[model samples]
Target: MSRKEDGTLVLNKTKIFDTENCYIYQRGGTESKYWQFYYWDSEGREGFRIRKSLRTKDFLIAQSLAQREYINIRAKIQNEESLQTLTVAEMTNIFLAKKKLDISSVPHAGITPETYRILKNRCEKLNNFLGKDTRVDHLKRSAFKEYEQWRKDGYGGKVPKTKTTIKTELSTFKSIIQDIAIKDKRVISNAPDIPKITIPPSEDEHRRNHFRHEELRVLIGTINEWKEEKTLRKTAGLHRQMIACAIELMLNSGIRVGAVRKIRWRDIRVNPKDNPKQQKIFRIITIPSENNKTGKQYECNCEIALIVEHLKRISRFNSPSDLLFCNQNDGKTFSSRIWADCWNEIIKRSGLEEESGRRFSYYSLRHTYATVSLANKVPLQLLASNMDTGTKYIQDHYYHHETEELTEELNPIKRTRKMTADEMLAQYLPQKI
Candidate 1:
């Protein structure tokens, strides 16, 4: 309908072209033979674009050809059978941008960063190895096994990557290409299966990441000491206390650090239904589906009921909408900063850093809650549900081999009185001779 500056005038922009971006446009003048069907096609090696060709001399014929080509493109997209013509680098950028948009678009998702930095790094490594090229289309599904070996053995001058690391990268890679291919009308269904990689028994086998009861007690005592020493009218002291609260909360409730950071004062209350007499603070922390990773509402009971009550009394933000652990300055959730500050200080001051064989972070609190609960005879399925994970994962990854706990359940052997040495010798010798 309109002529583009220094470009061809579009004959018409109709519904047929909107979804797939395929339409008719004349290059120079509106000569009928100059009419072209600008449609997406994988006929040539240039990996996917508005593939143009002079279809007919008549405008009406051009429209018919364009529509037919668009139909074929749509069919290819729906069937996921179209050849992907995008370079690996282009797909990587699109995928990362999409991931950023997903997090930002969702409110109260609890993830603070827009960048998936780790995944980005992996993608970059993939780009470096694959050369950011259209040759990515030549990646044969049959060659996936060879590619896996090349990844493991450091072939083609690429750095050797671990199975877990490579698996994550390949998953991202698969997701990216499939999405772009479908969107670009290159493919229609799910991407072909990438070869599976095995996770070694020792891969991330830090099963001792949980704290023992005595150690947890020591850590709590240290936190209390920290509160006493660090307590001041200044904002710094309050944040430290908040961090300590977060640790205690995670230790008891098995809530993730991400969910803990998004807690609001409005979400907490004493449920009278649970406490009919209203004599006790039957406190509850409501995790909304938006804030939780599982997208399920989880009501976490107060791990330390007294501490929860105390926080309620002394909270700087008492309003319903106020964040429970806000940054003292901005009045926003302090989850992003909690790890870099108070958690580090707690580990150092408690001497846990030097003693723990494995590195422990805020997540260890969740692990500890599960471990302690399991050791004390809590049901495995119940613990898994509480942890928002599977029973198999609990058995394989988080559960500690606390042999001492098992000893208590076994029947004790009765002790026989020791026979005198002469009586033992006579009994043995009579039989031996």
Candidate 2:
């Protein structure tokens, strides 16, 4: 217990008047309430106070009420500080920007510009659906379900987006929010409770289709004819070569279009060990860590050395450092849109567009390669390695064959077991022989 110079009782330099803490002092020889609660806070080196009123005679009640109010105010301040005041749109931007940076640093993150574009478009749609003022904290589990139903009902145009597309979009959103929440400590915890968007059953039985040998021949001939006729305006010859190389490379090596685009001239190494006279030749194409989607380097055996030779022939005319397949106009790399346009044009000219509702693009070449390789009895592991993808994916998506090599290996022993039905029945049924 302590007291001030005015003889008022003080507890730790805080004057206690009638069981209430207050600051009392003498001015002009008259004792008066400062009308504030004052105290030398914990460290006791300095003093602080909250004022109630200058003329208040009841110091005790005023101090007690002031302390209670102080506590409540402090709590309100803390609550406000703890909350993050960002809108959903702002958070999404920050999240995606960080993601872009992360993906850029990775050797092969598989998150391409096209992927970003698609994600951005989907996020825009989500933003529009949820409304601009919607807060991140306000996003409920039911909102995602609603979004799914809305997409299913065709929010924009055409049929509702497929379940796979919806799933991907939702996954992107979830990843963004989760990442932001984890990085920013002040943010409210709302991510874990959000439900993942469910994927609907696929209507299409086949995820991919492979071109037949005849179809491939027809496509090649049509593309060649288009090039010869100079029907394409911007890149007649280059597009022709690109499509041809893309087809041949896929048919031979089974590499994806993205991987094909990333291939440099130096990545290819021809086999010098093989005898030149016997025509036994092979080429090795190294998919660098940066070019591969899985971030794993793959050494693929180039089955069609002639295709590599043709690429090499084209490389001689262009800059050695330039991309293998470059745009004809400025000798730069072809953009994704340009690539798509070229494929669309080829499909239109080939007349295969009417037969198959879905036109075969560069990716179709990859699918064709996988299917053809599986048909040729390529080992699953080997196919996986060549494609620079996982073995499980290869088996799941491409391989449909049911034959077992183990049965063939065990056939010789089975051939000798020619027991008749009576002998087999006797062996099963009889104990007395």
Candidate 3:
């Protein structure tokens, strides 16, 4: 007999039958009431079945699934049938794959696999912090707050976690959970909102560690002395030359180290081509929009001519395909770690610390460049354009007005000689009286 012919089934009463070696059931009240379909093993054992609700009750929609389940139960033992289950690892992989696809299609895909790796590491740490058996449903906003506190307590020698980093990682985790919900509809039953992370204002403005002009002079002197020494002949003079060029370029152009390493011979060009003097002149280094971090072209001036000369010297020994500065061991582009090590060694030899009480690295050179340029009264807008960064960032980070200049500007009088205390007092008090 058909399920419609059966008496109306309310919340407690359900219409049930054994058919095709399986027990089938339909639960509903009257025609107006919602219905659901369920199935059990032919041997009357517990097995997988759809939940009773409006989603499964409509026979016109669920008849096919109901029939298929009955057929499967008859053909195979209920215990032998496989059921679908989604794991956290499986969900994470699926989420990352979808993220990759989305990033690839974007016009400016700032997200990279490295960024994904960092986010994944943070999630893994959070999972570990929650313990191994924690399920996706266990994640809540309060748990994230605890994680933030743990990070602030110094999880791994890093300073307190920045709100931006925390927000980004949590957003990635939220995306993964949403993906899981899409695949397994049951997961949508409980989804928690991600908490907002607060960023504290930075206390110290001068985070940049850079060399003073006098220290730079000493460093240059030390490099020149080392170049002239015969004992260091086996070492490639290329390191010294590269450091000199790097310092000069950073000081003059303010382009990042990544951009410097990627510069090509063709990118360096002079305008007014016909004039002999102008043709030889090194006026600008044009970084193509693709290689630049801002995805815009940058033009640096003749002050970078020193770097151009170094590039010309290096080019003679290598092809155009060769990087501007490369590791001798691997013949690959210079990595940041290697650059840092080189910087440390140079600083030690140059006695910069003893003289200035400050240790400067490659980035410091860039800061010094900007600071000196600002001190020279270079226009802010012009400097910003040359640096290929925002004018606001320059003003906020690099520009520091020298107090000496302000002092001189405010005081117009220049005393030729120091007056006696009595004379100074008389001059100051008696003029009006």
Poorest stretch of ten by lDDT in candidate 1: 105-114
Q: In candidate 2, how many Å is residue 105 off?
A: 6.2
TM-score of each: 0.60, 0.63, 0.58
| Per-residue lDDT of candidate 1, residues 142-209 (tens digit) | 53555566666775445543467677777876776677754543543345568778887756564647
Point out the higher-scoring one by lDDT: 1 or 3.
Answer: 1
Model 1: lDDT to the true structure: 0.69
lDDT of 3 by residue, 1-433 (tens): 2433336443433333435323334455445444454554324233344444445555554555655654654455444333333445555655656666654312156564445556567657545555545555535546555666666676623643245656666676666666564334233334566666765554233446555666668877876775455545433566556656776777677777657767776777666553666555555778777666676777876466656666666543355566666655555766555566667777789877666655466777778778888878889989888787778888787876667667655664654556779987887784663
What are the per-residue Cα lDDT tens digits for candidate 2 across 1-433? Answer: 5555766554323344333433442233245534545532221222223333434546565556556655654574466432235577777677667656654624555467777777677668767776756777666656665666677787733444356666666777677667774455335455634446555444344656567667788888877776566554645675667767866777678887878877777777766765674234567788877777777778887676777677667543345466677766666677877778778887788888577655467777887788778777788888887788778887667655535534764676757668778988988885975
Candidate whose TM-score is highest: 2
lDDT score for residue 258 of model 3: 56
Model 2 residue runs over 4 Å out of place are 1-84, 105-114, 152-161, 181-188, 191-209, 212-237, 275-282, 309-319, 344-361, 379-385, 388-393, 402-433
Clashing pairs in 3: 35-57, 36-57
Each model's lDDT: 0.69, 0.64, 0.60
Clashing pairs in 1: 77-188, 80-187, 80-188, 80-189, 82-186
